[model samples]
Target: MRPEPGFLATYLEPAQAARAVAALRARGQRDVRVAAPAPFPELMAALRAPPSFVGWITFPGALLGLTGGLLLTILTSLTWAEVTGGKPVVSLPPFIVITFELTVLVGSLANLLALVIGARRGLRRGHFAQGGPFTRDRIGIFCAGVDPAVERLLRESGAEEVTRVP
Candidate 1:
């Protein structure tokens, strides 16, 4: 079945947002998210999203690219040797430049691809609730896949404003 495509957003002051996030988590709501113009460490702690895999994927992809670049350099030099000043055909120093470039290229590409895939898996852009000027000046805590009872609980918990966008 397709996942629901809406979010419940509430605008609150930083401190209030933190509390709201904690309250949502305490109430067993796992799909909570927060957005703010500036950093909010407490809110981050409350959301507790699982670690991202971009780093892990990038490392191996970069290593493979480096290895491939080095192999290409070595094989090319050996297959088509051009003796200049009798220098060694397999020059590791020059290969370093190619390897480094390839590593960065592959790592960045892999990271971007992973981010796209990850975002598609329930990480689409979120919508905001209308809370007048408060939303621009305050933080927002949003919950996806909200149930009817959760809506009641949010209203009772001093949400100030709650909006569901589908």
Candidate 2:
């Protein structure tokens, strides 16, 4: 048999969305999702989700970039050593430029790749609360594992409208 339905979506202002998300989590609903016209840092904090998965990729990409930069500097300097001005074979100061550029380049590329993959995983798709004018001018909170009692609680909690979607 098919599993039971999940969240019952509701429209609210940004502030109300934050509260509803918090309340649902308090009531042990972990599968909550919210949609808003713009970024809602407050609601994200309420849900306890991380700021962005891109951040996780950034750190490792930076490390890899730096290592690659250092390796490039070392190999190039050693392979094409020039003793024109009695300078050191491995110039540390000049390598900073390559290191910095590589770090930024790799970090940006990794962030873009992560965002694309995330979108494929439904990060960019609309949630239940994404209907009507809400996608353009309002915020929404969708509480998963909902029942009739939960729906009533949401209605009583200042939801402008509640919708149940299959």
Candidate 3:
């Protein structure tokens, strides 16, 4: 199994995949990539992935939107100074709608932007198959650099199939 520098190990079960990853890390193999059909929290924990920063981006974006909405409505009202029937010109009730709308708009946009950026960055990390069962019912573990020991470890950890990357 320790045949080349790059190899793909396919696993049919999530627990086996997680164990493989944990074993790789324990053996000091840092360049490990995993592909799965769905999000596996236990696998992620085994990989020791950091918490996502999308919420950090979203919070600032939402704050900016809220401030912008408030300022836009308040400033336009002040600039025009259009006093209607009995309501005050710079009213708070009417501005609520616009403020809420902008907050949601910017927050969601920021969240989308963060995910796109993260995905693109992740794509550069390792070799991935263009088409594979990993996208359906299997999990793939891609090791950027491998040795015979790594390959044996993968099979021992329950890799059903192992192949050279290219």
Candidate 4:
């Protein structure tokens, strides 16, 4: 995929910027992001972002952890199979502890894996919006695509200043 090396940030009041973002989304502008001085529920309502997929990753991780744990325990027991205390060759009871430990271990590792994947995606060029001075009580509405229509929309939405970045 070709990366968009340049983007535009339209500075505006916090509330107006959030509303502008929402309006832009409603108009089918997909490559939009907002930066603000602080978090606000109104902004979230405006953005209407879908729920995060972290839970989906976590579920698969748990499944992998459980399977890995069971496999490890079963393999270890099979290799050292012996009748002890008049028990079966593969003692299911003793294996439970190992299986549980491995399950938790693998599950934790999966969470770490998911975090790394998410970070990688975020770091990709044009995947993140560049907001300037967002922490200084100014809100920035960043758009990845630039065109005369987009610029006009920003001006009509009450932007105090509009600038481009690469």
Per-residue lDDT, model 2, residue 76, is 88
Reference-based lDDT, residue 42, model 3 = 75
Using lDDT, give the best candidate's number: 3
CA lDDT of each prediction against the hidden true structure: 0.73, 0.73, 0.86, 0.71
Q: Per-residue lDDT for 1-166 in model 1, tens only?
A: 4445545656566777777778878988887777676677776776787887778878888898899889989999999999767789998998999989998998888888887877576345545434535336666666776577667766776677777756
User: What is candidate 1's local distance difference test score?
Assistant: 0.73
Off by over 4 Å in 3: 1-4
**Ordering by TM-score:** 3, 2, 1, 4
Residue 71 of model 4 has an lDDT of: 81
Candidate 2 lDDT tens digits, 77-143: 9998886578798988889899889988888888888888775764433454224565687666766
Query: Least lDDT summed over 10 consecutive residues: which range in candidate 3?
Result: 1-10
TM-scores for the candidates: 0.74, 0.81, 0.89, 0.67
| Candidate number that wins on lDDT, 1 or 3 | 3
**In angstroms, how far off is 70's CA in candidate 4?**
1.1
- Candidate 2: give the clashing pairs: none
In model 4, what are the clashing residue pairs, if there are any? none
Which of the two candidates, 1 or 4, achieves a greater lDDT against the reference?
1
